[model samples]
Target: MKNEGMERLGKDELSAKDSYYINVMRGLSILRVVLVHLGLSWFYPPYSQYIGIFLPVLFFVSGAVSYYSFLRAQSVGEYLVKRLVLVLVPFYVFAALVLLITVVFYPERFPSGIGVVSWLLVWPNFSDVFFPLNQVWFINCLVVMILISGPIFFITKKRPWLLWGVIIFSLVVSLLNVPFPLYAAVSEYSFFSRLRWGHQAWQVLVLLGLFICGSVHYRYLAGQSAKKYALISIVFLIFALMGYFYSDLGFELKEHAKQRSLYYLFLSFFAIYFLLALERPILRILARMRSLEWLLLYTNRYAYSVYLSHTLVLFYVEQWLGLTDLGGQPFLALVRMFLVLVITLAVAKPLGDLSRTLAHTVRAKLLNGIIGGVRT
Candidate 1:
């Protein structure tokens, strides 16, 4: 029993090498996310088509990390509190700051009087308006996924086949084009219709499936031999290429749009496998470049902040500098993307540092106060 307990602990703990590779992948994903939001329509083909792979990879990494986090947490309440502070607090802080800027400068972009109050009281919907806060839908969805992850982890652990079963069921539901009244009702209420339980069922289901896939990959595949991973990776890469070039089946499935088509699901799986296979070789090359390695690590550390804040920076850049006019020109688009990335990193890094400090201080104070009260 003691040996088994030790083995379990070993399995749950991620090695430094594995962690480093995952962080690099996260940095790459965040970069792709910024590019996608930059409104570079011409950038989507050939190279950017590969960017679609990043979302599933991100979801997978999140699942793996969340599972480890769950194991370390003393209780579900503690796990939730940490997630709320780490994820939601930064999101709300950044969101409110963006909303304030819009209300003051771009008043027309934001809703008026009672509508503003209502939107704040409920969740801000990304679909309703062209607000900087729209990008935060990812964070909102993540929060929802984390809330339910404990049950998911248990189910996946006890009945691995059940996880695949759920995935198939979700895929079938997506194909059926099932109508949801609750989705329609809430969608009318706010742009954040995806946050409505009934509206985003298929999306959440697919994400959960992806999340499970990530957990399983980290647990099982991460330790495999290079030749084995390479072989698997090649197979998935071929399938992904075939889907992208030959068929539009998965092209319609976009997470941001809350559409999880069957083709997109397969595409995401293939992309993930290809990425995992490349991790070892990529890390070896990155290790040789000390400066570039550090940069990626730093970016990954503050990726969430970068993700939340980049759109706002991009919006202002476009408004002030007229970057949108150069949209179709490839060179200008590359320049614009570079500028947005640099400016966003500058703003997001400082904001992330400040938010982390504030969150830590607040959490410490609250815990101390509670302990003092108990003593009293």
Candidate 2:
């Protein structure tokens, strides 16, 4: 953590009401993430395009929130434990249920080999390691960020020049034309081929860079006027539009997203700032509409569990119903996605409510035990 003087930013901390706006973004991000995971057809042109920036937005807001949390934390251990519990506990429960359902009901889809299980217990990325739980990558990535964010906070506070250097380096990594690392190390047929890089490699650097940017935003730019962010976002919007309309420019976020290209980087910046600018107006509109506001808040509140668990629901529902992407038909895709969405929401709400109760009652002791005696 930084000095008290740096930690305490008068009127700059994210108030509860201020954070509700953030939750708006969170709700939207996870919803789109789920839609993308539903395996919509490519014929839905620019369908995936809308999703490119959500992940970046997730990382950005996470970094911003992390700054506030880090400053408020009583100890580094506590900070780490709280964040870890929020992510890992729900995921563990979801994974166990997935395993039970897959093994007991659809044994054919159940994986073979203890080695793969080991990877799922730790990494849990894709079919290379686990099946249908590929959505877990974001959870794993968040854990990685939480593990390193403390050091990042300190670096940015005490040695900002060094942090900036790392940021610049990571931006380069994101913008590079190089293929994802570990592609050659593992068999091309294995899921590891799609893995970004080693612990210190590939998209991790770019993600960390954005995480740091969020922290910096919380630290230095939290209470700024909306016009400032709006103006900046407009510049990014123009460049992004240029890339979209003029293919020769190579600026399309959708095109560059999987590659993590330079164009995608600009698009990410544009999205983060654009949302910040709209926060106030959005909040106001929600305030006037009680039912819609409640729905959005509910989604935001339970998004963590829903986001993690929806893919499982999608897979199993499809399995039981014998549903497939039949000829990549858009109507079928939409119907399937809609069913999964409804089911996931119905299931996640009660679970999230129960989790909140547990969090209020025994979460302290539970998390403390897991963290080797850390008190939160």
Candidate 3:
């Protein structure tokens, strides 16, 4: 809570209004992440299908938030250091712990064993490989977005037109069916291809588009008409859904073709601008719930941990509860959802806290002995 020595562009923290939006969006992102994990192999139509549509918005919000931090930081070094220490450090440690657990306990998933240190070094594996805590793709993507936001901010600073052009181009790419090859050695039958982007060019372009939107938000949108921005968000959403649905009409178009660049762009704008647009109403509703605030706050803080661990937890929980069989019974799907939601929150949050505390204690002792001679 005490963000000392963390100076930003104009303020040390977001405005109360801005904080409200951030909190709401953060909560929404976490909710979707949970839903996706639970919905896996569940209902196939409509609601069961929107998980893909829902998760990308989190990335857009991430780009927006990271861009805000980038502008506020005194220097690039400060930005990178703070983000990595606070965000990336916890992510990597928790992910590694997950890998350790799966290899030790659920060896069926890790055929190569722990000796493949090189695999851990690569991030795409965070999504493709299900060792222990497997839902870490968002963190990896956000890390990539944060690292590049600076150059994006600088490049699009003076040229607003250029930024829009890049966004539109990325949107075009999203509408087209183009596979970005990341690995050639993997068997074409391998599941790894699903996780790897065939085109880094489009990925970076889309990230920049989101970054620009986030930057423009700070520079201009904040003080402007919330209604207008909300309308923009709505219009973008309509186009996104159109792209998503229409991609199947052509051979060159693929289902969910709106993913890479266009999806992040549209969803980022939709979540952010609409959030600002609905600031007053949302806060009033959320403020009424006193006890739930802690729950929301807890999720916001340890969301990365929850995201990392939920899949493995679900793996065990499904087996124990026999909920996967309920996929045939639509009503039972709801019951399973409720059960998974409760059990996951109960298990993941505390486990995440314990993991962080242990890591912190170990680091503290190691540093104290080196710096203070055991407090003589």
Candidate 4:
């Protein structure tokens, strides 16, 4: 009912200063995601290489926000309940809607009934059920990351060294190749199995490390002096540039596609840190454009909805107009991306409102039930 989009950083959770730059960054990231998915990178090859930072930045932001929320939570149970509703409900609602549409209009692409059941259960089958729901992987992964953060936060509240150890361990695991036997065993079980310890397992580890990095940055470094910020920015820029060149040279060939190790992770970190370091300058530039400021703010506010729904809209647009053949045409690509943006926002706005309302309603009911049971 409140119409806020997925409540990325509410007033209660973040101060205005803290939330503003985050909103801007998130807005930019979601826009980049939509553009990249629309094949924007095809027209400009370097775009793909540069945009790798977006997802990592998103995870970092999620980590910071999740940490703050965890701090304010009364109990782990309550926090987990709230998080599950907020994160998963929108995903399920929109995913089901997309599935139904695909079944009705493009049934050939829809998965079998068993696959549908598996998808509804959030079971990861190696099937087409996840194709349309591709981008929602971030949501799926975020839910797991946030769940892990709770225990990590509690355990490492006093022992900062333990937190670093966990991060280091995650990094080490991400860098190592999973044994062939282990990979083969996990590949056969189910989606959950794959998600837990298959190819995606490395992704989870890397994300966990980035999440911790974000949490640590927010806790300790968010309010540093301008000089310190500039120094940090310069250092991050140096590494980011180096990583960019390294990626260009193809030294880390899989870095572009798989992004499994510390090499790519450092690239992401450099980008995020540079963004943080330049926040003041970015805000200053944004201040000069009143209309652009409002636009970015609105985009930031509705980012979750946009991210969730944009791919579906893009798919429909491509199918309807046969845009696949227009790849090399820069003008057409931009036009197609613009149209996708327009249509995605149109659909996402209402769905996002519904998701927010449903999540809030569910939370209220659950909290009331818990309170009533205790009172009784």
- Pairs of colliding residues, candidate 4: 124-191
lDDT of 4 by residue, 1-376 (tens): 1233224323235657877788888887787888778775555555555566556788887777777776677666666767677877777677678688768876777877776765664543545643455666676678778788878877876664476776676656544433233323433457746344354544666568887877676665666655676677567667555555544536432444465444566667777877777888888989998777776676676777888788778777888887767755878887888899889878877888888898899988987776677679
Point out where model 1 deviates above 4 Å: 1-10, 39-41, 44-47, 108-122, 127-133, 154-199, 234-258, 362-376
* lDDT against the true structure, each candidate: 0.65, 0.67, 0.57, 0.68
Clashing pairs in 1: 125-191, 125-192, 128-191, 250-264
Q: Per-residue CA lDDT of candidate 1, range 1-376, in tens?
A: 2344344435767767778788998887787788778753335554455456557778888877887776666555555656556776566567667678767876777766654553543346454346455555566567778888766666565454455665566555544433443324433455544335445444565567777666666655566666676687677666555544443444433432355544565567776777777877788888798777776777788888888878777777787787787645778767778888889888877778878887787667755665576579
lDDT of 4: 0.68
Q: Give per-residue CA lDDT, model 3, range 61-141, as digits (tens).
A: 565566666656655654554454455556656656666776787676663543345344435344335534445544654
CA shift at 373, candidate 3, in angstroms?
24
Model 3 has a clash total of 4
Clashing residue pairs in candidate 3 are 9-72, 180-198, 180-199, 181-198
How far is 1's C-alpha from truth in model 2 (Å)? Answer: 26
Best-first order by lDDT: 4, 2, 1, 3
- Best candidate per lDDT, number? 4
lDDT of 1: 0.65
- Each prediction's total of clashing residue pairs, residues at least 3 apart in sequence or on different chains, is 4, 0, 4, 1
Residue 280 C-alpha lDDT in model 4: 81
TM-score of each: 0.79, 0.79, 0.72, 0.83
Q: How does candidate 3 score on lDDT?
A: 0.57
Error of 3 at 297 (Å): 2.3
By TM-score, the best candidate is 4
